[model samples]
Target chain A: AQTVTQSQPEMSVQEAETVTLSCTYDTSENNYYLFWYKQPPSRQMILVIRQEAYKQQNATENRFSVNFQKAAKSFSLKISDSQLGDTAMYFCAFMSGTSYGKLTFGQGTILTVHP
Target chain B: EPEVTQTPSHQVTQMGQEVILRCVPISNHLYFYWYRQILGQKVEFLVSFYNNEISEKSEIFDDQFSVERPDGSNFTLKIRSTKLEDSAMYFCASSADRGRATEAFFGQGTRLTVV
Candidate 1:
């Protein structure tokens, strides 16, 4: 079994500033994928960024990036130049090698961007 | 960009009643999935459908729950007997391929309220 943990339940960031959401996972599988998803007020879950366990380099998508430390079993999401639209509930997810799109998600962190 | 669409943004049902949630996946997608998030809880995977059959499902997807791809574009989740615990936001997702090979596009969730 795999488990993802988001220690922060709530986070706030000033507009144009940067914010980092922490995530950790316990998985015995060596080959896996990590993902960050955002759920806005509309209740739509959107993919923010993704990182492969084999890739030592972190994944970056525009303002969203991840600090993936495979050895530490940590994959944190960093949002730069945060905007009001970034306010959402963020989830950290894990996909084991054997499963087809079976994602294990964390408790999620509610992020608020203040102007 | 192509997107996954779900029907009936909200659904209200009585206990022991049967309810079906609908979704229309992207035209080119090869995989479809159903997930649910209880208010303030982590998102949980329910089932994955591919090639007109279920490829994978979580333990939460018990015999009481069923999934179907009735048409070329429609995927549905049926609950034989709805319970108060079944009340949550159900999301439909589709991906171009299986496993971690591709990212998934999620539809706006359907809020199920069981009373």
Candidate 2:
């Protein structure tokens, strides 16, 4: 069984500043996928970014980038130039490459971006 | 820019009653899934459906829970007997392929309140 952990329960960042959310997972599978998802008050789950375990290079999507350390079983998200719209609950998820695409998610971290 | 869409943003049902959550996945997607998040808890995988049958399911998906692709475009999760603990946000997701091969798009969740 794979388990994703997000140690930070709550985070705050000033608008235009950068913030990093930490995530770690325990998985025996060598081939897997890691993802970060955002959920606003409307309860919509939006994909932030994803990283393949085999990729040495991190994944970056505009202001959202990931630091994936396969050896350490760590995958963190860095939000650069954070805006008020970035305030949301963030979840870290794990998925085995060979399975039916079921995702194991961590307890979400609620983020607040203030002006 | 295709996305998954779920119906009835909120549902309120009495204990022992039945509730059905519906989703319309992306037209081209081949894999579908259902997940739930209890308030203040991690998101948990419920079931995954492919080729018109359930490909995988978690232990949490007991006999009381069922999934169906009754038509060409609609996927549904049915709870035979709702319990207070069943109150949570249910999410529907879909992808073109497996976890390592593609990204899964999620729909806005349905909040189920069991009374």
Candidate 3:
């Protein structure tokens, strides 16, 4: 069994600032995938960024990047130059390489970007 | 970009009634999945379907729940007898393959309100 944890239940960031959301997971599988998803008020779940466990380098997508420490079982999402549109519920997810499309998600963090 | 489509953005049903959520995955996707998120909770995996059959499911997916790919493009999740606890936002996702690098795209969730 695998579990993803987001310790922060709520977070706030000033507009144009940077914010980091923490995530940790417990998985026995050596090869797996980590993802961050954003759900806005519309309830649309959008993929923010993804990191492969085998890749030592972190994943970056425009303003969204990740700090993945495989040894520590930590994968945190960093949003740079955050904007009001970045306000949403963020979730950390895990999927085993061999588990097909089964994704286990964390409790999610409610992020507010204040102007 | 190709996107997964789900019908009836919101559904309200009485307890003990049957409810069906429908989805149309990406044209090239080979894997389909169903997940649910109770209000203010983590997104939980329900089932994954491949080749018209379920490949994986979670403990939350009990006998009352069933998944089907009745047609070439549509994937469906049915709750035979819904309970109040079953009220949640149901999401449909699809992926091209079962690889560590591939990512799953989620649809705009359908909010199921069981009263």
Q: In model 1, what is chain B's TM-score?
A: 0.97
Model 1 scores a TM of: 0.97
- Report clash pairs, candidate 3: none
Expressed as tens digits, the lDDT of each residue in B30-76 for candidate 1 is 99999999998889999998888899999999999999988788999
List residue ranges in candidate 3 displaced over 4 A.
Answer: none
TM-score of chain A of each: 0.98, 0.98, 0.98
DockQ in order: 0.76, 0.75, 0.76
Every candidate's lDDT: 0.92, 0.93, 0.93
Considering summed lDDT, which 10 consecutive residues are worst modelled in model 1 chain B?
Answer: B96-105
What local lDDT score does residue A107 receive in model 1, on the 0 to 100 scale?
Answer: 98
lDDT of 2 by residue, A58-98 (tens): 99999999999898999999999999999999999998988
**Per-residue lDDT over A1-115 for candidate 3, one digit per residue giving the tens place of the 0 to 100 score:** 9999999999999999999999999999998999999989886688899988989999999999999999899999999999999999999999898887688899999999999
Kindly report the docking quality category of candidate 2.
medium
Ranking by TM-score: 1, 2, 3
By summed lDDT, the worst window of 10 consecutive residues in model 3 chain B runs over B97-106
Residue-level lDDT of model 2, residues B2-115, one tens digit each, is 889999899999999999999999999999999998988889999999999999999999999999998979999999999999999999999999766377889998999999
* Model 2 segments more than 4 A misplaced: none
Model 2, CA-based lDDT: 0.93
